[model samples]
Target: MSEPLLLEARGVGKSFPGVRALQDMHIELRRGEVLALVGENGAGKSTLMKLLSGIYTPDEGEFFLDGEPLRATGPRHALELGISIIHQEFNLMPDLTVAQNIFIGREPRTGRVFLGERALEAKAAELIDRLHLPLDPKERVGELTVAKQQMVEIAKALSYEPRVLIMDEPTAALNDAEVRVLHDLIRRFRTPDTGVIYISHRMDELKAITDRITVIRDGRYVDTLDTEGTTMPEVISRMVGREIAAGLGPEGVREDREVVLSVRGLTTKDLLRDVSFELREGEILGFAGLMGAGRTEVARALVGADPVESGTVELRGQPVRITTPAEAAKHRIGYLSEDRKHLGLLLEQDVNANIGLSSIRERFQQWGFVRDRAMRARSREIVDTLRIRTPSVDQTAKFLSGGNQQKVVIGKWLVKDCDILIFDEPTRGIDVGAKEEIYRLLNELAAQGKSIIMISSELPEVLRMSHRVVVMSEGRVTGQLDAAEATQESVMHLATLRPETEAVS
Candidate 1:
């Protein structure tokens, strides 16, 4: 007969204060298969993963592993029972080395008295080598890039050698190449005795790697579909309970608009070199490139977060020297960083505090005193405008989903009324439905005469949202194309254009 299911959850229900996080949720994972779980942000995806990982005890229902009832008291217990989870947000200790972070609690020891640093590092090195990861075991985690840190998280989860693996938005920080490596590793991990539950909002990836797609909506199970038999549009419709239009891109060119900001010969000490571009009023300018192509560095340099070696920035034909983010703010330029958790949002604060933060001194302060009532009123208005899924403005920022947290950051800049906005990977870890909302919001802002510079690694996003696309390669502007001229093939060609080829051209 057929083999038993690898993992299953039945009638699962969970509730929190003022939130019915999940109710009547169910899923089944067959042996040797990759099952993709998809839904909009705050649709009980992470909540279910937490329940499976022993981070939370379900108020009702049961979980079965290998046809046996499975109950875990805590995360450690769950790991001991052959279940491991990699959360979306990182849990690495920044001060520690890679090896230490990977095997923190379980370290080799000499007779249980002294820690074996070399042995620990050697073990980590072997794992990294086996996974084809470019990482140094002795390197400090805080010194590593966000992409590398994500790799470390994957390594840590795999170190447990669990029978069932659950990964939540595992590729949010990864590029195309890194994603390939991760997919290969996942393939190697899958066996007849093991199964995987892959949770992500990247529909393309779900098609590439998963065997079955299970959709959940509003904290409840929707339907499962065979990957080969389903279309992405159908899956999305099931996810959001409606039909969404396809091929949504820039409406038209903005060539006739006035140039509001111009950069010439932009260079940084590390990577950026001779980057130049112009952003028009009420235009959406896109920055596109491969990983390490210095796209993020351009945004950082423009905002004065990174020191620029040589460059000239002009606002409406007048040159301006901005040496700090405060100066950029003075010029009404707001930068929303890609690393939103660490750089964009104040996780410890509430939604109101985060939304009102950038405008406090100018809009919510009087006579050296903070105005709480006015701030709350304005924060509520932004909350409604952005449709941030928070119970109240007083809810902690950390408690919101990744998409809502991103919206909170956007709301911060909107409250400041910045005329020039830079969004760096604005939809990095957000779901499809939320991405649509963010896209709509961006178009709305541009129509309101706010200039936007959108830096994204996703080529489709750049092609869809940009009025003019600027392609960068090895820290230099390789080419600029209007919406009509920018295609996947054309953009990729310029993205791979090297300095030698650029000089030749």
Candidate 2:
């Protein structure tokens, strides 16, 4: 009655130093079905993805494709065999055009020497048309927004036209409207002759996109459920092997005090325009907006990560000029960038070094020399506090999971005793369990009188975390709402405010 399995991994196992990444894992992707791979961060979902994509070979187990033995070769070979993967991180080259990035290796050529630019754009245009995307094929990848970059990634993968397509957190950077387009495309792409592996941590997308759900915990096979029949609580319980608390974070409400950070008429060369808001002591002030709505730009300009043409940053009513991130940090303002991998940590360095980065001079160093003992002690304390999963303080930062890496960034700020902190998409690429931990940490920090400005794309997250919400649209603060007034509907309305009318609710 049902289509036969297109691919299966039997008793697959993989391991890395000091970590049993995966063991005794079984997975199946059936043609005509979207298989959802659900797991917590560090649950070996990534490991399993790598194996299926041919980036990594399983130490144990076998893969069968259409009942034929499939030896794990490599990515190119995998694509040749009708298997393709879109990594969680963007794999696009910034300097190249969208068309060039998509058709890099297989570009149309002129006389076997020059790349046929027109032909390349035409082919990319065909793919873009099919997806109903408004993006220009010849536009440089670096110039596009995060959401557009995500679309380019999908376009590139779909170009391969594989029978088995794998997507890891494809909707992580996309907005609600863009996500709808992606879901529609995925539904259309999944035919009886094709199979799809949908790996994501977004709970709302699980049943909406997938037919069957497979749960993996701690690198082991847990259980599988029909997507329509399973509930969120059931899926989560299986992922963590226990009951997780119901709410996003623990209940620790802080009473608002005097304004800690006040901004007036903040303007940037790109995106942000005349933005003004105030963050109070012991408050979690959330910045909510759609893609390219200037939320991140405001956060960056506040911490001097970007130049502000005209703006006033008043810290505790004291007018301060923040011309650089270092100056901001010196003034007790810490910024956690949304692009954590590229901007947050020194990937080649150890976890301890990153944790002690902000206060290296005063706290972890002395007399123009390094203080290894102090650094190690402080790193251990923060790692323990943040629950960073690593073999030791010396573990490389790049090897840590996305959530752990986020914790390290948080640790950097915490070590500096920063009072004004800005967290931009703090939980992006993070699993649900780790997300709750970050929320708990944020709530705890607020309770401890830390003023926070949190920028998030998810409306539910905005409502769940913030005592007050600031909505931005077209580089302007459209509205501000207290916790009691900031419903999803109200936030959406403000986020989509038009330029002609200024609506501050």
Q: Give lDDT tens digits, candidate 2, residues 1-505.
A: 7545799989999988767898999998887899999875578888998888789988999888887877759989898888889998888999999999998899887677755788889999999999787689999999999889998998999899989989998886676788899999998898988989998766667868999999998899999899999887677667657532234322333445788888999999866778888888888999987666788888788878899999798999999998899999999999999999999999999999999988999787788899999889989999999999999999999999999999999999999999988999999988899999999999899989899989997666778898888888768888988877666656655765553356685
TM-score of each: 0.60, 0.61
Spell out the clash pairs found in candidate 2. Answer: none
Residues 1-505 of candidate 1 have per-residue lDDT tens digits of: 8777999999999999768999999999999999999876567898999999999999999999998998988999999999999998899999999999999999977786646788899999999998888899999999999889999999999999999999998886677888899999999999998889999766667878999999998999999999989987677667666432333457555568889999999999878888888999999999987666789999899889999999899998999988899899989999999999999999999999999998999999999998999999999999999999999999999999989999999999999999999999999988899999999999999999999999997777888899888988767888987777666656655765554355211
Which stretches in model 1 have alpha-carbon errors above 4 Å? 1-3, 109-111, 122-148, 173-177, 244-314, 317-321, 332-505
Deviation from native of the Cα of residue 308 in model 1, angstroms: 6.6
TM-score of 2: 0.61
**What lDDT does model 2 reach?**
0.85
User: Which residue pairs show collisions in model 1?
Assistant: none
Q: What's model 1's TM-score? A: 0.60
True-structure lDDT of candidate 1 = 0.88
Clashing pairs counted in every model? 0, 0
